[model samples]
Target: MFHHILVPTDGSPLSGMAIEKSVALAKSLGARITFLTAVEPFHIWTDNANQLAYTREEYERISKESAGGYLDSAVAAAEAAGVAVGRVQVETDEPYRAIIDAAVERGCDLVAMASHGRRGVAALVIGSETQKVLTHSAIPVLVYR
Candidate 1:
């Protein structure tokens, strides 16, 4: 019984599949969808002081563009399925945090995302964002692999 569904996409094949799944689920339940993409902020290296001179405004602009492109695809898919949808592009270094924040801000009833499905050493080395969201989010999460 989901009224609003939040789907995060990173332009990956897995994320594409997740978007499709989310759209289908929303259509079946007569729910609206929110497609979100988080762009990573530019990293500043103190060792290379010259690089630190980069403007934060420039970084924010680039991040917004990047996230917008990814979210556009998800929006297109939802539109094709005749599902009502909204898009959100957030600039954040922490993708999981951004995703959860968007969901809460949008008042989404559920979050449907794709898992990278990392395992063992890889999982430990590059912690799963999906896992982190599952652990920390107050809203319900449905992961698609």
Candidate 2:
């Protein structure tokens, strides 16, 4: 019986699945949904050479546009499903933290998100944000793989 559901997405195929699932769940439960997207801030010192390709201003602009696109798709899905929806965007490298914080700030009772289900060395190397959110969040988490 979640009154408010927080749906965090990255615009990936798996995240799209979670968005669809959460929209259906929200519609059934009569819960309002809040879609959250976290955009990484521009970092001057990064190992990735691609990051250095853009200036700080340019990188921030590009990141915001990309994040906005992701949030827009999620919003469109919820709207199409006739579900009440809101959206939040934060500039932070720690997406997991942003997800948890947004849920609390927005008074969301549950977090519905996607997981790649990576395990072993791959998971450790990639460092799953879903795993981090699961570990850190106090609210209920519905993970869609």
The most accurate candidate by TM-score is: 2
Global local distance difference test of model 1? 0.75
**Residue 101 displacement (Å), model 2:** 0.8
Give the count of colliding residue pairs in each prediction: 0, 0
lDDT of 1 by residue, 79-137 (tens): 99999999987666577898889899989999999886222110110138888999999
Clashing pairs in 1: none
Prediction RMSDs, each to the true structure? 5.6, 4.4
Measured by lDDT, the strongest candidate is: 2
Write model 2 residue lDDT over 104-123, tens digit each, in one string: 99999999998852221111
Off by over 4 Å in 1: 46-63, 117-127
